[model samples]
Target: MLGPLQVRGKDGPLRVPPGRQEVILAALLLEANRVVGTNYLVDLIWEDNPPETARTQVQICVSRLRKLLAGADSTVSISTRPPGYVLHVDTGDVDSLLFTGLVAMARRQRDEGETEKAVALLKSAVALWQGDSLTGLVSGPLANKAHQLDEERLSAVELRMQLELELGRHDRLVGELQLLTHENPLRERLRGQLMCALYWSGRQAEALEAFRTGRRILDQELG
Candidate 1:
């Protein structure tokens, strides 16, 4: 659900066969324990041009997934219910769902003036990401969802930075902000944050340069 799609068995990581099986499993995992219609999957995988055998092909993919999962931990599974299928697992079993839960809890903590606790929870949430969301599967139906997840991660990061800055931890934040701003140069909010961190840490020249760099990039690329 986060980064690459992986299944854990009693031993260790289970290898999911590549191709449609990977996509089907990803779709089912996205809607764990909820029915995902067969037609929707056909449209998602084939993308507006599906052969007549699409449904059968989907069924075959599901069968292969089931066989692969047979060796996986019992807590995860797939079940057919008419027009669709369901992937059964605890909410905590899914990294993305767990990340969402942590972020929500952190937001509640932040709203209640528990800024330290909020930052801690946000750290946990951010640590769940191994890399960009759905890195290999984003070209298909999961594109929008993957983008949304990435946005959620970014928001969590920014919120944590704000809280830490407010707590007067700007010294510790400068290095992190540098890396984030480097990775996401086009994100103006992150750039602003990096500038603030640099200024607060007494690197006033660097702060001004950060601002200048952003202005230059916006003028040259977006103008």
Candidate 2:
């Protein structure tokens, strides 16, 4: 559920029903195991101007999703509870959850002075991202959630590169860091890391220039 509204079963990928149904499933999966309230889901599906039949539409969407899951032979289940529903699936089954666990493990490894292991784990974690979270389905609450997840992904990348720099792999990291800083000019952490990588790579002038560029951007945009 990280990249798209994909629901894989024992056989293969299950075709998710279109429109509000997909939104409902995404909302449930995002809060998997926790019962999401009916009102909350209604807001997610229609933003602010839901129709009078919005609650009934939500119920119908849930019902369709359940049948789709059953048809696909998915281990995942949606159970109705007071106020709303809960998506029952293993945490590991969700890509974002798995990525988060890997990132946590990587951080632990890095804290333990195991730079190589940390780098490897972070690489695996970052690779799970096929694209932006919930791509092509941005609406309402999920859009904000997706943006938050993307920030986490960028942070993880920055952490991984920081570990690489600590290993004196500055020469190899300079190119990547430069591009990342260019893509996210306002990201102070990435800019700082890029400056460090350039300095350690024996490009002192380039490092100073990077700092100047970042400072200018910060002053211009933030002030």
Candidate 3:
């Protein structure tokens, strides 16, 4: 397993094998690095109503997932407590958590005016993203969590780029910021960064053009 939720070596994002086992694994990943109550897991899988054999089924799923993960650098484990079971996966092994930690560190470094170090940390954080979080996972609470994580990841990228620009690394960042602007046309902050980078790169006309484009986009998209 690439992670608790992300299975690797597949043609694409790992498909959660169709069944209750997949559901259980997905839930654990959504709550990755946290202690998820068994009660909560049951509720999530069965929507507050479980089969007479629900507890047994959950156990089966957990057991199977453990075996599935054994072949890889298995860090995921099932922890049993009085109230419920917790899937304990290390945060460093999970890309999203790693990204979050890196971004947080980068922000702290940036705030401390360690621009070069911040840039390095931020780049590593962004590089951890394989693609959209839980790309092939079934949509539900788990998907929402993935989306939220993705948002945080993107926000970190923007923050890092902003810091780089502030450090007069705009010339180095112009290409990346320009690409991000094209992909995230509705993100005003990204557009602003693109403008800043362009202006500092001695492309005053491009900076003005970017501002106009952003304004037009906001007007058209929001108005």
User: Against the true structure, whose lDDT is highest?
Assistant: 2
> Backbone clash tally for model 3?
0
* Predictions: Cα RMSD each: 1.2, 1.7, 3.6
Cα distance off (Å), candidate 2, residue 15: 3.0
Worst 10 residues of 1 by lDDT: 133-142
Expressed as tens digits, the lDDT of each residue in 1-223 for candidate 2 is 6677788899998878668888888888888899999999889888889899999999999999999898888999999999899999999898888899999999999889999999999999989988888887847588899999999999999999989988999999998998999889999999999999999889999999999999999999998
State residue 178's C-alpha deviation in candidate 2, in Å: 1.7
Clashing pairs in 2: none
Residues 1-223, candidate 1: write the lDDT tens digits.
6778876778887788777788888888888889999998887788888999999999989987887788565568888998889888888889989999999999999999999999999999999888887667634668787888899999999999999999999889998988998888888988988898899899999999999999998899799
Q: Judged by TM-score, which candidate is best?
A: 1
lDDT of 3 by residue, 1-223 (tens): 2223565422444444666677677677656756677766677677656799888887787777777666454556766665666667767666766777888898898889899999899889888776777655553666667778778877988888888787888888889988988888998899999998999889999999999999999899998
